[model samples]
Target: MSTPPPALATPLSGPRFQQTSADLYAQMRRTHGPVAPVLLDADVPAWLVLGYREVQYVVSNPEIFGRDSRRWNAWDRVPPDWPLLPLLAYQPTMMFAEGAEHRRRAAALDEALGAVDQFELGARAQQVADRLVDAFAGRGEADLITEYADGIPLPVVARMIGVPDAETADLVSDVYRTHAAGEGANEAYARVRDKVRRMVESKRRAPGPDVTSRLLAHPAALADEEITEDLLHLMNAGQLPTAYWIGNTLRLMLTDDRFAMTLAGGRRSVGQALNEVLWEDTPTQNFPGRFAVHDLRLGGRQIRQGDLLILGLAAANQDPLVRPVPQASTGNQAYLSFSHGEHRCPYAAQEIAKVIAEAAIEVLLDRLPDVGLAVPAGTLAWRPSPLFRGLAALPVRFTPAW
Candidate 1:
């Protein structure tokens, strides 16, 4: 059996270890100087890669770095006899799977998502946004994050995945809160697992054209257990990160007048503006946790087998080595926020950008030209989770065009 690496000592007394998400990122860059290595959570035995190249190297090179969460101490922190462990058990989702398995899952999701019409999705997004805004527009003061940003993406995912409209809101809320706070993680997991199992069983009785049905039809040579795991993976894929990115993007646009104006023009500039927002405010600041499968050398550091590796996506995205070229025709390459490797967030960023951009054009900017934050910029409360950066609420008021 491979031995675990030494535990990380507690962080030094400095502003770097502060709880502020933005500050923690800044300190990582300053102290690590691009490729410098830091440890996370004193007891977690992980190395943080803060440079652009280093992060890319670690993430993309699956042979050296792996996403087998089973190797990490995360589960160990929980009790071995805990029922939650089984529910929280890491499944071989696209994000955790490597090689052929990952490719297969990606292809399935891509095919399903590809079937969606961009224009139609945009229209749907606008309708959702309009209804949300209409509910609160009359109130004058509204929390954009809770009322709009958090509410919009769930139905979009539900519609795509073929969940009934009536159940989408509750499921989405449960999954979002569970994933974000690690609160009710087990309960949320169990709830979704049971739901998917029933859905799959029902589909067996009578299947439809939904994404889940499509996956069930192929099964891709996977077992029933694997199918259940994949379904849970899909549930997570559609919830937490989308909530984070949408909320973060809206916050950015509200804070910067130029960005808001640019997006108001229409979908033509929406993509570029969204890219800027992602670069400026990464949704997932820390790298998705990975475990070293074998002895590996990365950025002049020797990583032995069993070492925990944390690729700092937010830090790498801002690395001066990969300078952001706003005019780059290729979109946002400098930003490693979604990662760039075997376990990268697989078109998630792109999808969210499209939704947010389309909504900004069709809803916010065009319909509420004078809409903006009622409070000053810095007063907005950001979510305090270490994994994702997002606003808790964005209280804003605007003049209705109607």
Candidate 2:
């Protein structure tokens, strides 16, 4: 009546696992066409869905694919005092919930975010961009990732969520690094959890007109703890990848003369450029990890209950079968950069595009005629993280048009 799970195998060691995972993806694309079996972590045993179609299959089918963090073995490796389990326990937000709960929370968020005036937000974004650009206008060279990309998103998020100015900077910084790859990820999570708990308590006492306030006002719809959880999810979701997207888009345009020239001439649509950036180098390379709830077949491989399943977003976006049209063109081929289906990021793609185009790109293009990367293209360093791909720092030099 049901398909049996695939045979589970232990993953390769840490360093080998990372290299092997990357290699396996390349090999799968070459051989299997779009989807292939790969491993998740060195110590944890899990199957990675490295093709676009397979990822879509898993993401869209929650009955087969579950997003509960409890399914992950990485939990065992976390320190006993780590805040991850408590955070998950206290707030099973949409990301960690399944079925109806996930859908309900997602709907609420969509309504709240959608109700806001995007055009007004765009005007606010322009002001934020102008201030940031002015801060480094005269400097011939600066780390765009640190000075510009990272700084722009914080104020916007704070305004969106009603975080006070004094606490915004530290809170944004802690949350950004919480899920980052490396040994310090756990510690970062702890800091983020503490900050979030404090912020939630503060919001509960004095709710304002921000997203958090709106959630609190609808207490009958969601519990306080659930509200906190969703806030944390929004904070993490809104900050890190958006920062990476901004950095990556700037880097891509700076290094590629054609892209830069096109943007400069105003011929290239900002929306198209944003879409191209998402497809070319997705900020989140891997899918939000999911688990097989029952015996199931995906990409011709059988998976059983409790088995960990990872959907590869980066691999999926490049699927030949999916055949995503160039960002400049209009078509219906699926792209997995922000993912698809129930658990996918709703505002992630649009939010990134809006901020970068209306805020960052518009400011930069007007002020700098030939903004480009200062370091050699080959020398740029990508932060080593499987879940997200971005530059550690992007150094650039430009002459201000003014």
RMSD of every candidate to native, in Å, equals: 3.8, 4.2
Residues forming the 10-long window of minimal summed lDDT in candidate 2: 1-10
Task: State, as a TM-score between 0 and 1, how close model 1 is to the true structure.
Answer: 0.84
| TM-scores of all predicted structures | 0.84, 0.85
Worst lDDT 10-window in candidate 1: 9-18
lDDT of 2 by residue, 299-342 (tens): 76666666666677876766656654444322222467778888
Model 2: per-residue Cα lDDT at residue 185 = 55
Model 1 stretches with alpha carbons more than 4 Å out:
1-20, 33-42, 73-89, 219-224, 260-269, 324-331, 400-402
**Which numbered prediction scores highest in lDDT against the true structure?**
2
What is the lDDT, from 0 to 100, of the residue 286 in candidate 1?
71
The residue pairs in collision within model 2 are 6-302, 52-316
